[model samples]
Target: MIKTLIIDEETVNVLSYASIKPLWFTDYQIPLSLEQRIKRVQISDKLFLISEKTTSESKLLVIKVNSNGIFSELDNKDKSIAFDRVITIALSQFGESISPGKGWGRYVSGKKLSIYATKRTQKNKNRLYFDTSPIDTNHIFAYALDSNNNGFENIEVDESLFLDSVTLIDEAINSSWQNTVEADDKTQYGIELTEDLYRSFGECLNFEQWYENKLTNEQRSFVDKSYDEPVRLKGAAGTGKTLALAVKILKDAYRFETEKKQKRLLFVTHSFVTAQLVEDMLNSMDSEMNWKFLEHVKIKIVSLYDLAQELLNYNLKKFTPISKDGKEGRKLQFEILEEVLTKKLLEAKFKVGVLGKCGDNFKSAMESKESRKPLLLEILNEFACVLDAENIVMGSDNGDKYLTSSRENWQMHLPTEHERRAVLELHMGFRKYLKDLNVLSMDQMIADLNRYLMSHEWNHICEDEGYDGVFVDELHCFTRPERMVFHELFRLNKSFETKKLPLFMAYDIKQSVDDNFICTVKKGSGSALINSTNVGKTNLVELTQVFRYTPEIAKFLSDLDGSFPALDLASEWSELTLKTNTPSGAIPKLSLYSDPVDLIDNVFKLASRQARSLSGKKTVAILCSNFDLFEEYLIAGRIKKYYEPISSRDDVTKLGRLKGKCIFSMPEYVAGLQFDMVYLINLDKVEVDEDNPSCGAYRRFVSRVYLGASRAKEELHISACESRQGYSPILQPALSSNSLLMS
Candidate 1:
């Protein structure tokens, strides 16, 4: 009788030369690759005769025979057999070189074999062959066979070796294989194989199954808690803030169904891409709660911009917000501002003294054609963050309000009433241009919707159609007026008149990359929302442990956080920390290439190799810092097969359907999503002058790098071409702390 320890479809081919047959085999249902399956039996005990039959020839085999049965069947007269010859013959079947040495020790595949002697025999006289290869712990102590010919025929079955070998092989197989066994099955050997897979690879790739049983105590508490007032959940990147919010939505749908209550819930994200991601998250949580129940609950997941468009369409017959034209609305707004400045304001008697009063070389910046864009952007930021955000209309009572109001956050650029009046004039010109076109900007659309929501007609409509609860993801991206709209959208539930509306918001101030949106949530301000007087009191919940990326990534991000003093001041609303609950992984690789083409080629080759080795079981992202590099990689035919460019909302919406291809995107486009591995290319393109590290450009550049680096859940590869000025000054902190490996 023979026992099969492990066998695959290729087992028979490997065993054909030895003329061995396996009687029975057990299907463990582990999804191991063919190579792994072959390696498993190649390093197994000789007695474990493992073989499988398929439609084609088998490729792997591991044989384990019953020692007593084999010995008894041998002729009694020829009691002594050459055990070394048998071991050599069995190993030769694998088609690898084997060197002979004293005792049982030999070299196979450049790995030395260790000799283990049975207690009954002398240590060096009678030995068993065990390969102690550094290939991995799985292959350690794999082979076992007697060496001494003196007592080879009298070799008794070593029960201890037999049990230990089986246990080691079982552990190895479980680690390499996917846990495909049914949860209800009682005969399964291992239940934590999926978790092991997540730790080895990354949980982001297997998100549907990753968090079902892996939620930390803090995450679970957030999901299961009932809110009296509006709740604000704040955490650094990878802290599971979005995951907790999704689970709460699922649980709420379940509770509504159980109570036989009809409820309307709203989930708001920053953009169409993030909205699609939220929908995918909800669909993936079907195991936690039946998704069909959500039909009765009437949950709406939409981006704030889209929601504003829908509301405007409902109120006015033919209203359309200006299309951003693939530049995230920034390019279009810049064109309008340029038209207002160069064509309208500059042509008119524009107060040149106002530019001089703005300080920090504002006049020189406006005079130079090359430096004019940043100047225009600063003026535009004032309009968006102060004017539109506060609903201050030019030539109205709010004009006086803007001049007298505390511009503490805006004092750097707008030092006095002169600059404020100039910005208001530009705002008036921008509005006139938009009014002539009959199309509103995204901010204008949101402002109109906010006014509509505050109307008596909207109050009457809300009584019957308003949402019972509202959830906001990435709340830091929303401006003051946008935040106010969330409070107005939810109706006062009759059962909880004393409590605030059930508005839940999750945000991390460090991840806010938009220059137009300024964070106003102060430390110990007793409010998490900016200008919270409009939204009322809210409760803050901080998630301290990061469950997405490894400790190495966490430390790298923490070092980055400490390097930026401006980031600390901006994030004073919460004490940001990056403590991780994940295992330690490879330090992020920061490689500098002399040639730009070589950097791109090397990064893609590394990604391709990783994709092949993982068998497309993991997701990879290559985030380019600028559009030029992004487009360059998109057209490069050599690496096109390995990745798909996520440049538009349609591409982002199809992310869940993408298979066997890495995601190629800019850092800003892939916000609120994560990957198994991330490669940030062209950090040298991110212009940040060390002399003015406190500049807004430096802050925006740091935010972009942080966003891209935080996307990696397990591994991060950051590469750049060495410019004439050397590496980007932004990497100094990571380099000084030795948090990044120079590959």
Candidate 2:
């Protein structure tokens, strides 16, 4: 006897009504009469069909019967079968009439079942369930279905209800059939199977994937280009030089790969932080390809100093550098010179007759410690000038000319021959003293590498084997001497084969903040060690598209640099605008406070607000001029627990503190790093002049502020104490502009 089950609206909504047509009912092998009556079917170990339905006064009555259910059960005792087997039988019922497309999958939620046949253009889906409760007095079979916006008019159904035509492509239930749960044994007449079957599918993308997805077409073209010779890529801040460099490196590595041979690529940067970032990018790119394929294409990313140290010690010789620990070693050198001068003065009875006409002031300055500091610094500066220009790394002709120019530019007067002789002796003696201790300062090490590379051994080695490609990021921080060393070490390949080695350099000259190591190209007409014209073999590619900043921020940065080349907005910059929640038309914020405390407070408030907008892994920074001020602000802000102070020293190893925290950084150390927001403090301390474009102080100030401003990808909040000396006159135009948003 067949019984009828009364269904309510809530039950119908939960069971999601959907159509299921019998396109291949003959594959089920049920009798023609039974197949005709089978209006809706529920799939499990046994199949139950709702042959007929009737609408009562207040409910809908559905009759479901299981007479010789077509699907066979693997386990009869428990009435269980494989979930995949049920899908296979159900799919076969449709057979060749319905193109299965990319096969079929099912999703189960409690008693409800959702199955979909996926195709590239369209999806055919169905939902099913079977239940029999004695209180209900009959078995009920439910079905749910939907289409993926590809239009449902093409879908044919025999005896099933249609759901609203909402897109179900993203619905998680489409793949839920990968898991199976057993029904209760005492569910009256339904089948129950105890088994666990779940499988995870689909591709999982990492962070780099999301980032690279927005690469602009021009940037992609540059990255994908195969260079036959060295290429120098110049760009302003936010121009994605580092990303392009990484892509170029990967392209070169794989493009030059041979069946039995491989090429070596060396990527050098200015700081450990930047080097680590490059290395991480390379590793991520490498993982996308077969690891075995990359075995031959070995890539080493390191700082310039690291390369210097390795090359210096490559011959099993230990030439350790003496640690000055914040001292430039000039003070000790000055003391030695003073002692020698004092001895000479005593030998000459402190007489003006025996020494020179200008000896009296020099003697007085040397006698007192307070008066001697500046004079000593001057002498040291001149001495370094001589050493740098005369170093073995530079070309002999230019080195000699530079040495002559240095002597001509000397400020101090040593008129008498004896006094001049004594000064020369002091300089020579200082050199001897350093050599006696077997200690080489960075200067001495650079000179040593220069001499070593110029030797016959290095010349022969380069002829046989040389780096296939040399990629340098943050190239703006490399001084003339360093650039010369890099050029000779890599570019002095006497043999230009079928493929000329590529030396790729990426830098923004405006970001060179450190006075001691400013970019070589802007030094002078003749000072560029890596210029395209000066060096006829080199190629210059300017990446004129900015990606990291909005047009407002980019224009502001351009104003700060004054001399920085203009750039176009990147196509991908629209995505950056979408990600950054800053209001449209917002310029970099510049605020002047009467009180230092209020300035710090306001900066922190802004930082806190910006931090909320970024993910936990994103970083924020409070950049100051020096360490002492950084510490004071870090303590006063009462946020030392959440922030770490990064050092400005050359050997800083505190990179592990960069992620998921705020940082107190100096302009020099923060190069090649970006934060979601930057609080540039102590701007009043920077010295600047509007009248004198040639002023070194003004240029340095502009460079430093440019670095600080560019470090911010999303927001830049600059504050200055009203009473301070303040920054350069170059910023006057920006400050006076109405769009600058001064508070």
Tens-digit lDDT track of model 1 for 1-743: 23324333233223222211121122223323233323333234422223222222222222233453222233322112222233333332332221122222222322323233322234324344333322332222323445444332354434444444444444343343233333344544221112111112223422334445767777777676675667778888889887788778877876787787888888887765565456556655562324533556877777776677556652123334554212255546877887777764354356455555555565566556656765687776666556776688777898998876776643235667766776787788898888786667767776688788878777777866788888988877766666778877876434355667778888887777655444444433434344442556666678889978999998888878854535334324444476776888999988888766787778877776776677657878889876556877788887777666777433453353344567788987777677889999888843666787766667767778888999998899988887534467777778898888788
* TM-score computed on alpha carbons, candidate 2: 0.56
Report the Cα lDDT for candidate 2.
0.47
lDDT of each: 0.59, 0.47
Model 1 has an lDDT value of 0.59
User: What TM-score, computed on C-alpha atoms, does each candidate reach?
Assistant: 0.64, 0.56
Poorest 10 consecutive residues by lDDT, candidate 2: 193-202
Point out the worst 10-residue segment of candidate 1 by lDDT: 190-199
Residue 90: error of model 1 in Å? 63
lDDT of 2 by residue, 204-259 (tens): 33334523675565566656556576777767777778878877776666655645
